[model samples]
Target: MSPPRVETVLIVDDSLVQRLHMVGLLRQCGIHGILEAVDGNQALELLSALDTLPHLIVVDLEMPGMDGVEFILQMMKRNVMAPLVISSNRDLSLICSVENMAQALEIPILAAWKKPLTKQHLAEILHHSPDRPPPSHSTPETHKEASSTGAHELALAISRHQLLPYYQPQIDLKSGTITGVEVLARWPHAEKGFIPPDHFIPLAEKHRLIHDLTLEIAGQAFAQAAHWRRSGVHLTVAVNLSPRLLDLPDFVSEIDALLQQYQLPAEQVIWEVTESSLAADLGIALANLARLRLKGFGLSIDDYGTGFSSMQQLSRIPFTELKIDRSFVHRAHQREHLRVILQSALDMAHKMSLVTVAEGIETLEDWKLLREFGCNLAQGYFIAKPMPGETFTGWVKTQNTRRHGRRGS
Candidate 1:
């Protein structure tokens, strides 16, 4: 086989030791072309001066003068699209805040490492990088004029039925069989092509259009599930629930109506509520959730362990599932502490009689690890990317055939 291509990397840190440590790690990973910057200003200067930007940038959040947030803001302002990996010894909350800020700024972040970075983490980042093209590269900037749409535009898209549901399959780790699929919203604009949900979901919530959007997507998902049932797939469908939707007085009734309309059993549908969303006004959220559970819908605490009072939330709410966030699941194979934490989470979920689903399983190692830890289900790029209903149906058929073939063999 031919030698692997060497990736160009840029490392920015205020400490010489940290910079040198990163250099050593990168070189060990077979990355030869590496650049160093001591601060954010210096990094920006290098970025502006370079004829070709590095494939990846490793940055420190707590710098002497120009901090990581400022550097990320500057990068966003300049429309720099290189993937960033945040490496710091800071607390997890602060690191997560920086990550959330980067996402808000639309900066592509490959991964974040809590300092003392390792070769395994670097290798994992490189392994996942090929699949996630910088957003700019994945989608052309030809429609710059129509790129950023406002709430009015989003409402119009909803009315026009432009927002659609795409399905990502969840697998049973033990059996390696497809179990369920998550419903992710996608907006395919005529001018801009596919618009990511992160771009429009906040706008929808701000404009009171989220309710309509959620219902529309749920309707499509239920319809698809019904079709699959008739075709003998019998797959469960999960849809994310917005906190605002949960607060609506008639939200439970609306869900009931949707299930009744589709003639599908409530047990076949899952309503996923993020832990962060549940942290606000739990009285109402819990009530809605309880009613849904009473009506036979599966309730999952999405992105488990990312928010405050996760244990309290689990104790108070009637959640039937716990989804370990991608951040923890992705790194469990490299970090023993993370692996222990994941194992504990799985143990807790099992003790509570809740199904465990690990998100963002990118490699076979991650899949195998989750199975070893007794996780019930796994989802992410490793199994399949989200696809339209038609494409998902085809994928399900193929998976079934493969399973049968293995049995026959």
Candidate 2:
């Protein structure tokens, strides 16, 4: 009744410590018949020697010879079809197409682990594997709802222009005045009401639709930001960039054209790079980020502290903002050690001249704690949930009017 488990994992890495630690953890997590390879060559030989195939492979990005990426390429040459979870210090597998980069090499990346691994990171990798699927319904509407929140129903929503930017205001600690808004995409299905990004983003990625979705979201966000700039608000609006678009040869040029088309100043539109997405190809990713920065776009490191984006990478990656990942912020108030961690992160970001933003704030205590740490910008449900551009504009106007009346009275 153990669900007829059919999972065998091969872990390849050069570090003896990593190998032992990972193997022990996999055993703790219910992994079966684990195999070890120190480098790509050994891993290749192991597969060649075996008649039965490994159900899964976990690889470190770095090894003495024929690194993890090279191993994946070779696996493609042999047409190995298995689920893979890459463990690496470099974080490159998450952003780059590990499965698609090598011709005809297909591996399902359950997840990528950033180095000096945490139990949480390991759990996440196991949970995200292709072997596991989050609970779902069997209805077609659910699938359609997930696909685009009725955005896919072009006939109904295309004319309606249903795609909208929902802004979550980020506050400045010194003054409670809203310093900026992080633009998040929202799709309202006629039947479903509000469909979350998690529901559809994976589908979009699977269908290679995120590239276009990113552009559409940017266009909408830029227009709203431009409107605010015109009204003397001059607030920075950050939009998440889809990883698929990052590698596109013309990503930089495309963004430039969109900025011009919307008449949005590049400085006002902050481009968010998620940690997992950029870990895959630092060179290519950083190169594109540099191009964006040179063109006047503000670069922000999204989900900071969630991956292996070292301080060195931040200093060299041309980022203008460091968003403390919610994991650290959520526990900062309850735990003393966590407070030190959060404070250190804040201190480090400020030292680097990167504006620090706290994400996933849920409680007033958490918000106050972040503010106490000299963390300036923040976003979370405690502040305001993401809503349409119109809703955000109205919220801003109302806040300003209330302040004006309070002062006059």
Which residue pairs clash within candidate 1?
none
Q: What C-alpha lDDT values do all the predictions have?
A: 0.86, 0.74
Per-residue lDDT value at 374 in model 1: 94
Each candidate structure's TM-score, on Cα atoms with residue i matched to residue i, is: 0.81, 0.62
The alpha-carbon lDDT assigned to residue 249 of candidate 1 equals 73
Give me the candidate number with maximum TM-score.
1
Sequence-dependent TM-score of model 1: 0.81
Runs off by more than 4 Å, candidate 1: 1-7, 11-44, 58-81, 85-107, 111-124, 130-147, 278-283
Task: Estimate, for each residue in 69-95, the C-alpha lDDT of model 2 and write its tens digit.
Answer: 888877656666566776676644342
